[model samples]
Target: MSLSQQQELRAILEKGLPHAAQPYLLIAQALNTTEAQVLAQIQLWQEDSLIKRFGLVVKHRKLGFKANAMVVWNIADEQVDDVAAQLSSCSEVSLCYRRPRRLPDWPYNLFCMIHGTDREIVTAQIDAMVKKFSLSYVEKDILFSFKAYKQQGARYTKQGI
Candidate 1:
């Protein structure tokens, strides 16, 4: 989808997903199109990679995950796949990704975030992950959020704020 289309869909999502009275119908009303057309367009957007995912944005802290930390790992270059597989399998991990390591200043390459009710629990989980993977070189750090200014999806459209 072009920037304009993405922006339009995002604008609608910002308002909220359609209600049960008429899900697609409501979206269609907002977009000034038929419900079927909206559904087909959304499906196409998804299939074509214009939309990565569409779902509820749950608040982790509200659900008791009060402690969240970014776990950066310096896995053996050869074992990145193995490590990422293990990390992704863990339910506590909410996000994981692989990126190039900036050595000397930043040695960790693979990043995974774990959420828990408290810092201690999160630390314990990280320890378990380390021991389970037998990753001796992996360095773990707990990054607590001191403040949250903007925690929401990206605004696809650039409307005057």
Candidate 2:
């Protein structure tokens, strides 16, 4: 794509695409381009590694998920991948990933987010996961969220790129 097309796409992305059945078609109309053109550009960007990922970000609290917990686990290094795959397969887990352990203070590396309508439900789900994964001996912690915050997509304009 040309520089101008890239800038226009970035501008549209900054404000986020509309939530509709044919959002891309609407975007194409606004950009004075065909849907196929818009989609092709997106695919090209992905193939060139310009765009890593694209997905919807939801406010769990607004959807009745009142209790949110960031569960951190210190799984054995050898089993980290296996355990992470298992955790990622769980329906209760909305997000799961691995990070480097900050030794001397924090040793947890695997992290996952579990959200529910109540604390009890969230706790039960965590308990179930622990049992199912045989994580009784694993060092883990659950940090509950007490406040809801507005979530927004990335803004390329603000990044001074």
Candidate 3:
């Protein structure tokens, strides 16, 4: 494949897939190529590890989810894996991950994001998770987002991404 065409395809995909019956055909037409070529190029990119994966970045605020809370927990190192797994399985948790805890000031090592239509809903969900997991005495904190930033996938090109 032409390097310029490959770069163009990458740049186009970074924006998002087109909403159409045959999105690949539309993209192929735009790039003056066949739909099969477009699909094959994407496959090649994936096989070569040029692209890790494709997924949607949901706009929770637009979907009526106004509150997003990142609850950080300081659980025992031995129990962290179990607690994180439990938290990750919860439907309310959008994201759950582990991070190194900073001593003296920051003690939270496990972090999970919970989103809801309102603060109360998110808070209630967090409370339920805490109780369900028996984490009442665990050191933790809830941080709510005050603003919604523009969210998008990775940009391969400097312009039009």
Candidate 4:
């Protein structure tokens, strides 16, 4: 893709997802192009892996999900994939991803999020998950929402948020 096309897509994503009622058509109008063109570019970007994900960024606290926790698992390297797949299929596990362990201090690779109305609920869910999965080497850290920082897509432009 040319620099201009990349810039246009970046702008659209950074400015927030396009409007409903034919959002792609609206974006096409803004770019002075057809909806098909806009869609094609989006598809190409996704194919190239330039677009990681597109979805709502819900502020859990605002939505009454006051309890936030990160459950880290120290599964064997070979078991990581299976554990991740199982964790991802659970509704309580909002987000699940694998990361490299830091060192002797941090031995967990699989990370999952559990959000609920309170810490007790979140803890119970995590405990249930650990028992159900038979995860012996798992550690959980409850993250209280003191404040929420910025949450948005990457903005390649030099403009302000």
State the weakest 10-residue window (summed lDDT) of model 2: 152-161
Q: Count of backbone clashes for each model?
A: 0, 0, 0, 0
1-161 per-residue lDDT for model 2 (tens digits): 56776678777866777888998899888888888988999898899998788877787688998899999999999999999999999999988999999997999999999989999999999999999989999999999989766566666764323
Clashing pairs in 2: none
* Residues 37-128 of candidate 3: C-alpha lDDT, one tens digit per residue: 99999999899998888888888789988798989999999999999999998999988999999998999899999989999988999889
Candidate 4 lDDT by residue in tens digits, 1-161? 45776687677777776669898888777777788988888898889998777788777787888787877777788989998998898899978999999889888888888888888888888878778888755564555555567655556775423
Cα miss at 133, model 4 (Å)? 0.9
Candidates 1 and 3 compared by TM-score, better number: 1
TM-scores for all candidates: the values are 0.79, 0.79, 0.77, 0.75
Candidates' C-alpha lDDT: 0.76, 0.87, 0.88, 0.78
Residue-by-residue lDDT tens digits, candidate 1, 1-161: 44565467667866568667787787766667677777777788789998778778877777877787888887778988888999999998888999998978988788988877888888888888888878656665667765556667566455512
What is the Cα-based TM-score of model 1? 0.79
| lDDT for predicted candidate 2 compared with the true structure | 0.87
Worst 10 residues of 4 by lDDT: 152-161
Model 3, position 140, has a per-residue lDDT of: 88
Lowest-scoring 10 consecutive residues by lDDT in candidate 1?
A: 152-161
